[model samples]
Target: MAVKITGSTGGWNCDFPRRQYMSPLFSAILLLLGLCLANAINFTTVYEWDKYDFVWPSGVNTSNEQIKWNVYFEYMAVFEERLFLSLEPFRGIPATLVWFPISGTSTAPPKLAPFPSWELHKKDNCDSIQAAKGMETDRDGRLWVLDQGSRNCSSKIWIFNLLNNDTTVRVHQFPDAVVSPSFDKRSLRDIVLDKTPDDNLAYLVDSKSENIIVYSRKTNKSWLVKTPGRKWVSLALSPIREERQLYLGKSGYKELYSASVTDCELKNEGRSAAVKLIGEWSYQPYRMLIDSSNVLYAAFFNQNYLCKWNISEPFREQRIHEVGEQDTDWPFTFALDTNGIFWMTERNDTGDWTKPRHKLLMAAVGARSYQFGTSTDLSLRG
Candidate 1:
């Protein structure tokens, strides 16, 4: 079943995810006198689902085990007004790359329609998406998807023009050597891109291989930045073009590291990138995102609450915008919208796999994506 989700929990789901109504605050002691706001640290639930409803194709045997198992969504990306999400290859997921229109309102839970079309999402079909794990979008109306591949396929990078009826614009499969044949080298944790260069460079972090894979759309090539012993799972790329930095977050480590995006690009510079320890946090960190305002938004692997720090400052708990509640929920997958709204989802799946314990929340933080720009459309959709 592939159709859009229009349901709203009343009047909450359709608000502008971004806004300019930032509260005034003063932190003069840190020299960022009026930079941080308290409203930026707290989030509220916009949509709640006890379990998701899929619009399945007609005549499909829903009783089949393969199509009747648990389904979990762990990756998300918001483009214009559409909130794109990917379900883990949890047996019953019919389509991994699906989306819902955030502007619509309905009483039932939103339905996720497969991107492009359901025909292009056929399982085991090499031409179709085998498994879509992570995704990121830019202001240019381009959606970057990381397909983790299946038995007869190899990991691939997919670029779809969201502005052009979600057309497939480019598909680059990673060569065996680039993704390593021996181990789970293609365990891509996340994907991010630098849209300025002609090469159209994109970076992916391999959680299993502990390396970063860089892909170039112009050259149709890819390379691995080896990290042999580390468990580098999450990564964030700076939006600052003048001085680009790719920040690395080790799964259970307290330190955050970085490397110059310029040095790790595709030109075959013949030199290994020098990794630098950018800063350290009180607790181990997980996923990360950089806003257009140059602030680093981060989630901890162990902490329930989220925090944000200006890259120019040290990543200390005392210096971050933190919510003091016994924050026990993690933003399983989150994305930033142009309106400075931080959207996150929390999933609580337990013994009863049938129960849906998922929530889509949003926090207007007074910042936008690193891509930097405003859309003419006042609505979340651009």
Candidate 2:
């Protein structure tokens, strides 16, 4: 006998043959299968670091007196087998960028170190990093660094080619026009690279100014968009194919507004334009991840749950996993691998902000038994 199954509950239910249902052994086997399919999500702790484990660079003084000072790590990216981490300049520590191999032993995490001196210097100046928070690696083996320059330095984006001997390829400084007059300093938060076959673009978020700055590699020019009619205080961009969508979120607000990609062409002189509202969500997302299947995963700011929403019909949110305890520090920034696993950094919330505790974690969302629709995976290059 054949059975037909369909719905949002993962297509676990079916109309079985009447004779098969009557058999006790057959009924028991079916029950076990259903239970296994329901519990597909799993969370694992990949690496954990105590306050004393974070070692300072070779030149920096690691004496007991200096060790008392605090060090905080912000965003991270993975390319091949290497994991890159950015150290936020908190409590007088120099803003440093470092990376270590991911194949280290589980009992002992790899040591943290600064990026090579030759790659960091432009001409004669060394220690070019002021304050960096977000970074992304493209398919062409280039690592994009977003320096906020919150420490009185100029805001700039540094692109380094990792595949070709780790060479510094380009450095683009934000023009004065991109900085808003109302804010005392420019806060360049996150970066999203869109490398379509025809277009190469970078979308940088100005969280404090409520605008987005677009950079074109072909023209080597940058433009700013106000995102008219949308309150984009917590702006985030996720590009899928030719479509680049914007996600807006606020701290206390319970809703998220999304807009379609602006229609501005790269060849046009005026690259800035307004975006049209396409969708909205009931929960406020601090960080977002979309899979190959167009399934959206969100980590909330005020809540401790990791929520998943189906972009297709019946856009309902399902709380897949709980990340942390109530009113605690949760995953601030996260990245999704091609295999559908989430790599996130969890900071300590209870004690002093300087000596914050951190953990590198991984969560896997298993495949569903039901077919939702046709969708494609988001490429890191784009």
Segments of candidate 1 deviating more than 4 angstroms: 1-40, 62-69, 182-185, 264-270, 318-331, 350-356, 373-382
Tell me the whole-model lDDT of each prediction, alpha carbons only: 0.69, 0.58
Off by more than 4 A, model 2? 1-40, 52-59, 64-69, 116-127, 180-183, 229-239, 242-244, 250-252, 265-273, 276-283, 326-330, 351-356, 365-382
Which tens-of-lDDT digit does each residue in 1-382 have in candidate 1?
2212122211111222122223332322122222333223566767878656666678866565444335566678997688998777776678888888777666456877888788978888989998887799876889999888887777888999989988999999887867755335457668888775465778887777656788877888888776556757788887647668888887668788888876534335223556788778766766788886677777776454566677767655433333323224343678887777878877664534464467777877677776663222324433
TM-score of 1: 0.78
**Worst 10-residue lDDT window, candidate 1:** 4-13
TM-score list, all predictions: 0.78, 0.73
Q: After superposition, how far is residue 266 of candidate 2 from its true place, in Å?
A: 7.9
- Model 2 lDDT per residue over 7-114, tens place: 433433445454544559666456545643453346676776655334454675566544433545556677777777776565545435777666656656566655
The candidate that wins on lDDT is 1
